[model samples]
Target: MKRKRVVCGFGLGLLLLGTGYVSAQSPNIVIIYADDLGYGEVKALNPERCKLETPAIDSLARDGMVFTDGHSSSAVCTPSRYSMLTGRYSWRSKLQKGVLNPWGENLLNPERITMPELVRTKGYLTAAIGKWHLGWDWQKRDGSYVFDEPVRGGPVDHGYDYYFGPDVPDFPPFAWIENDRLTAMPTENSKPDPRGGRGGPLVPGWDPEAMLSTMAGKAADYFDERASDKNPFFLYFGLTSPHTPIVPSKAWQGKSGMGAYCDFVLETDHTVGQVLQALEKSGLDQNTLVFFSSDNGCSSGPSKSIKLAKELGHYTSGKLRGHKGSNFEGGTRVPFIVRWPGVVPAGSVCDQMVCQIDYMATVADVLGIEMPASAGVDSISFLPLLKEPQAAPPRETLILHNYYGEFALRDGPYKLILAPGNGQGFGGGPSDAEAIQRGDPMVQLYNLGDDVAETTNLANIHPERVQLMTEKLVSSVARGRTTPGKPLRNDAEIDLYKKHLHKGK
Candidate 1:
């Protein structure tokens, strides 16, 4: 593919070039974010050990640049999503622990600029289609949700011109939501699933099995509508498959003989193919920049089914340690592929560190716009890497957090985990309580360059290094933003080593 260089100058505060300037040649951007997908789940990322096939995702790797050291900002869903959109750590927000509750208040502050909102300044039409795990302000009466009125503070309010998908696939009001209103008010309550997930008001005869296909179809329809439009579009296609309530349609049930989770993985790949096919069908493939990644690592199903899958020969996290909700490489390290014809070199691989939070700044660079000082404070543009795969890495250090709010600092190859055990999720590591009782070291350190699996703890061997990294982590949290800028205030007080502070030190 021929390289197309985009030339533009940058200045501070919201498209400083001019208020009327719009890039006539800006490429359409599509971000396909998978839910709970592990690093090795994609066949191309771990061909030797991975059991399942992901042709659509693999094609993205073959067509563009694949980052071996890519990661989500957090080891869980909501925080990672927040960071991806806002270019700031979720820990800086009030949500320090788990995800947003169903029908909870919007986690995004109204004053903050989102990816969609930023792109709108460049005259791009933005749409968020698929699982929006972010909160919604559902009208409630006496603690119960009332769906008669439109919900507030959703994708539309956060910069998206169009929005569709369930607030959460497994959460209440199990029906389709377009823009701010439910497609059909739930007239009945859903029964509890035998697998897991809470039951709540549901649309009558809503088929969980068909959910993935419906989202794909909607995305394809969206592409068809925007194909001929003059202005470029930004589509955040967040997939809901391969997560909880793991339901693979009947056609894909036995496609992967491993199990339901594997089957769902296959179906998720097909969903990617559907979106790609739609883009191609609409004649937008050559001009669209597409990103494919996951929110976090694979979930260890109930009864250690993922462990059983590993025993049977499917290494979800590949050679990495821990699973979802851990500070280990496996939990946050994810499959990241970017495809942009005439820009990103095909079949190129980069081993430099990159995080999802950098998306906001990268998009800003691509559109030839400079973000305000307050926005994308943690984001460093990787646009140079996309243009020149051999360019020096834009980021050298990163802060990783798990579902439990445990902090981990990564500087070069050395990783410092403040907490002892493998933080939450299903990796079967020692729990905080168990580690405390066993008198395990409070701090865990590993050189990823030497210990990708994180099997050996080097904290005792290198106390000085641990102290240095710990101080760096503290400074990062205290300063609010990671990148160079005016220090901002965190929405909540941040204690880097909350529970295991005294024990570890």
Candidate 2:
């Protein structure tokens, strides 16, 4: 296919030189974020190995640009969401460990310049449609439960004009919220959900199976509402499926022969199709810049069913090692596809190492807005890669954080994991005896270009390289931001080296 470098059509105006300014209106932006969807799960990315079929997602790759080496900022949800929206690493903040609990305190600091706020500055209408798991300040009903007092310090406070979704489907009040208040107050207690983790403040007859479809329907409705509006829209549609509460709706029950997990993934794809179809019906597809990606790699399947999934020929992580919460590619690597008719070339593959944190700068570049020194400090725009597939990535050094918030730095193909431990927690990687027998070192290092699976550790083989990367990681942490500008103070002390060394002891 012939590639196009020109950025025109879809109402994008004149690109002024030097000064970040656009003469005309910007395009509509829609980001479809998947929860726990793996790089291998999408058939187009892993054609030879992927077992489950993801036609809707695959179509996005076929019709747009597919990033072969895209990643989330962290291995888990809250941090990933934080970095993606704020364009700064979550480790720079106080959340260095596991995700937030339901109705937990907001992770987004009040002063941060979020992605939505940047887009809104370009005269766009911003809306967060699903899974606002980054945390919220809720009014408590005494000390044990939460009341429906408008959720303060949430998406609305951060940047979004509207917000709707379950706070965290996996760990939740078992209800949906629109803007700040619950769509319907919880009138009954929810039994332990069969899908996965479940908790109280449940609405009467709330069905986990209906959540995805409901969110999809709401998004479609929103599209309909905006069909006639002249202003551009930015929809951050966060899908909460293929994560836990693995309830594949009745329509998708027996779709994927692999298992319930596969079925849920198919349903997730179906929801994507619904949103795309809505855009098409609204005549918005021609001008919309749609991005499809996952929060992180797949987690261990329900009740350790990942082994069963492998037996059924479905490798969720593809050739990558470890699952979510590890320091391996399978933990942070995720599928990223961008579809913008006319502008982004169809069926192009870019192998640059792009991080979700870069979304802020990418949008800023698209809108021709200058990002302040304090904002998006870690973001490096991959916007050039969108126009030219062979363009060099804006970033060279990429950081990966494990579930425990341990750090790893990747420079070129070589990656240096700062501390000793297997990628997966709970001693999940090869047994220590096996690793010792294979001569794995205290700190792990691998050339991901040659060893995508991360099986071989070369820490002891190249001491100088390890020392250099370790120093870089340490400097990045202390500097407060990775991109240029004077260093800022971190919210709290970040000592990932200590955390990784003492973890799983």
Candidate 3:
């Protein structure tokens, strides 16, 4: 694809000068967030272990910088998405545990400034397309949806100018939503899913396999429509693939010999290719800053297990310890790739600690905007690292959480889990009791520099480190913000040692 320069608008030029960073123009930002994609699933990230081929993702990595150490805020979807948009850890919100239930209230506080809202200050058009699991304020009465009314507190209400896609692929109201209303009211109850998805009102003849294709087509259309627009745009292209209802389209059925899961992964790669191709076709690829990452790690849904993929010599979590809902490395650690033509070094790799919460600050820094003190309180801009790959790490510490409110703090290479065991809600290793029975320590610690797999526990060996991290974790929660500013109050009083105390550890 040939590079095309976008002339900087006068307003953007002034903004650039104000922030002391000069650029030709503000680049179009596209975040391609995948659901339940593991760290090693990308062939380029784990060539020796990952069995499946992901040409589109691999090509993306080759065209940009790949971060070997990247993570989501949580090991679950809803919380991760929440943190990604707001730049605040989800634990600070009322939802300190698992995901929001179907027809649940919006997770984002209306007062909060989201990624889209932050970027729009500089006149950027924003659209959020596909799989908004963060939650919605559905109009409901008498224990059912009021389909005629527009959903409130959705993507549009927060920051996006437009929104589309099924709210949750495996959950309720199986139909298409455009903006804040369903394109077609779901008048029929969905058939019992063979893959064990929740039964809910669905559009007539709703085909689960077609969701990804539809999302990709809509995204392509969006790029085409906005190609001639003067303003730079931001698109949050969330994918529902490889998460649930493991229904690969007929064309991709057997493309991967590694069965349904692998096939779905390939289909996901194809969708990514479609989006990139669309960008290229629109001649916007050159000026677009593209990000590719997952909400969490690989999960074993009703369709197939990560174990089956492992049986075929494809380690979804790479060499990490646990899967989707765990606090272990496998759960939150994910494949992160950033591609910004002419700016970021191509085919380069940066092994620095970064979290999804940094998106807000990073975008702010890129656009030369100072973030509000109240918003993106946990975000630390990695813009320096993006400009210079070997720059010192933007953040020295990171906090990780799982579905069950389990906490893990990472300072430098050493990680300290507040509780024993993996703290996984699905297919995890020993439970707290099991770990106790197995003579495990009260807390778990590992030096990731020497043991990325988290094979041996070092809590006993590093008592001072454990105590220091524990205090830091508690202080972080108490302070309610990681980055320096006025100490904010948490929405709820968080008990960091709840799990440990419950298990008498």
Best by TM-score: 3
Task: List residue ranges in candidate 3 displaced over 4 A.
Answer: 1-22, 301-306, 424-427, 500-505
Full candidate order by lDDT, most accurate first: 3, 1, 2
Better of 1 and 3 by lDDT: 3
lDDT of 3 at 455: 92
The digit string of per-residue lDDT tens for model 2 on 1-505 reads 2333333332254465353334344678999999988888888887767777788888898889888789998888889999999999998888877788766888888988999998887778889988888887876566756655677887889899998888788776788888888888787876677778676768887878988889888888888877767778899999998889889988898888767888988999999999898889888888788999998888875624367455766678888887777778888889988888776778778888898888888888878888888999999888878877777768889998887667889898899886666533531465333444555576889999999988778888999999999888888888989988999999998886753244332
lDDT of 3 by residue, 241-327 (tens): 788878899999999987877899999999999999999999999889898999998885642555665567778888888878888
Each prediction's total of clashing residue pairs, residues at least 3 apart in sequence or on different chains, is: 0, 0, 0
Which is the better candidate, 2 or 3, if ranked by TM-score? 3
Measured with C-alpha atoms, the lDDT of residue 303 in candidate 1 is: 22
Better of 1 and 2 by lDDT: 1
- lDDT, model 3, position 58: 91
In model 1, where do residues sit more than 4 Å from their true spots?
1-24, 302-306, 424-427, 500-505
Residue 309's lDDT in candidate 1: 57
For candidate 3, what is the TM-score? 0.95
Cα lDDT of model 1 by residue, 411-447, tens digit: 9999999887865334547776666667878889999
